[model samples]
Target: MELKDRLLTIAKEIPPGSYPVDVGTDHGYLPAYLVKQGIVSRALASDIGEGPLLAAKQHIEALSLSDRIELCLCDGLTGIDLSDKTHIVIAGMGGETISEILLRRHPLTQTLLLQPMTKVETLRRFLLKHGYRIEKEIPAYEEKKAYTVMLARYDGIVREGDDFFWTFGALPQSKKKEKYLYFQSLLSRLEKKQKGLQKAQTQERTELDRLAILIAKAKEYLQEELYDHHSGNL
Candidate 1:
């Protein structure tokens, strides 16, 4: 099975011996790919709706992976078992929804790979405040759309981050060129929002101030990157 860049990034994070449970598995592509690649012996693919679950079932059956991949119809790990060394994967969902799923039923799985389609800062804030430490974040872009796959683990250490941390979670420190692109994307979004607010002639002071700060930070980061490259320090 072929996986998209976003799903492939998430798949790369799964270790060889893992028993993964893909939450909200749209078409069961990730699980089937992992099992077919010999990365994992078996995987459980679950979706909240019957339509998506049936679609996944047909895909698995066509791939001759029905025995290796199990399909379940459940709402965000509500009835899933995590007693074994299960790795949780929640992708293609909103950040608020992912946060709600984790908040409702905190998994015992050692690792969680989460990919939020929107409101990524909200998800990062919730994860840190609720004792889940973001071990790593891998950025992926497909069709000019930016996405990140966050590898997190429950460490029981609650930490509150500032606006910058919430906006760019350990991305600035990354050596990958995608880090700069991600920052640029955020800056573009914020600039557009500021323009919209200004055009309406009704601006929220707090929001405008936050945007100004983030914009300045992003510019400074890009400036530093350019300087380092020119100085042959990168």
Candidate 2:
């Protein structure tokens, strides 16, 4: 089965011989792909909805991967047995939902592959404040929409992140071109919000201040990136 670029980016972070559990496995494509490609010996795919789980079951059965891929209908990691070597994948969900799942029951797994559909900064802040280290982030684009898949691990040391870190995470260290595009997208959104707030007489002061800071930081970073590209320093 062919996976989309976003899921493929998440798949690349899974090392060989690692056991993976995909939460919210809509169609179980990721697990099936991993097992089919022999990246993993076996995997567990789960979804909270019965319809999605049934679809996943059919897909797994059609692929003749029932023996290698187990299906479950449960909320995030509620009944799954997580080992230290297990890799948890939670994608295609809002950042707040993902955070709530992680906060509900902390997993013993060492590695996590997370891709949030919206509110990326909220997820970043939750992870950093709760002792997870975002080891790396990969940028993925599909159908003109940008997404990031993050590889994180628990270190048990809580730390706070600045506005830029919360906004972009480790994305600034990504490839120059992808980084530039992602930053530009973010800047555009911030500027649009700032303008709307400026025109509103009832705008919240705190939100306006936050937007200004983010916009300034984004411009500074973009300028640096462009200069480096021109100077052959990238």
Candidate 3:
């Protein structure tokens, strides 16, 4: 099964030899692809709805992977056991839903591959505060939309109040170009919002003040990237 750019990015993050548990499996294409590629010996595909789960089952069978991939119909990881899985892939969900899934009890030892569709800042803050260390982030552009894939693990370290990384991300060196584009896009939206709020006389003006700070910080980081690469030559 061929995966989309976002899903493919998430797939590539899965470590080899990992026994993966794919949450919100939808049609189970990811697990099928992983198994077909020989990245993992086996996997568990799960979804909350019966329809999706049934669809996943059929897809797995068609691939003749029924013996390799297990299908479970459940909500999040509520009733599942994590001992057998080394990594968990939760993608194509809103950040809030991902946060809620993590909020519930689960094995801290399992690495997480998450791709939040919206409210990523909220998800990043939650992960940092909850002792999950983001090891790396990969950016994927598909269908004219940019997506972020995060690989994180429980390291018992809490990072707090880093708005720049929380709003954008502290991308790995390999993804510097992606990081620059993300920050640039974010800066544009924040600047426009700041301009609108500046014309208002309400207490909301405080938001504009906050936006100024964020705008300045994002610009500084982006400029630093340019100086580090181009130097006086630019």
Top-lDDT candidate index: 2
Mind giving the per-residue lDDT tens digits that candidate 1 earns over 117-200?
A: 998989999899889999888877777777888999998899888988788775535535566667778779989998888788
- Number of backbone collisions per candidate: 0, 0, 0
Instruction: Give lDDT: candidate 3, residue 103.
Output: 83
Candidate 3 worst ten-residue window by lDDT: 225-234
* Best candidate, TM-score: 1
* Per-model lDDT: 0.85, 0.86, 0.84
Model 3 TM-score?
Answer: 0.89
* C-alpha root-mean-square deviation, each candidate: 2.1, 2.1, 2.5
Q: Residue 74's C-alpha lDDT in candidate 3?
A: 88
Question: What lDDT score is found at residue 148 in candidate 3?
Answer: 86
Off by over 4 Å in 3: 199-202, 226-234
Error of 1 at 96 (Å): 0.8
lDDT of 2: 0.86
Q: Write the per-residue lDDT of candidate 3 for residues 60-121, one digit (tens) a residue.
A: 88999999999888889878888778998999999999999888964267999999998998
Over 4 Å off, model 2: 226-228, 231-234
For model 2, what is the error of residue 34's alpha carbon versus the real structure, in angstroms, after optimal superposition? Answer: 0.7
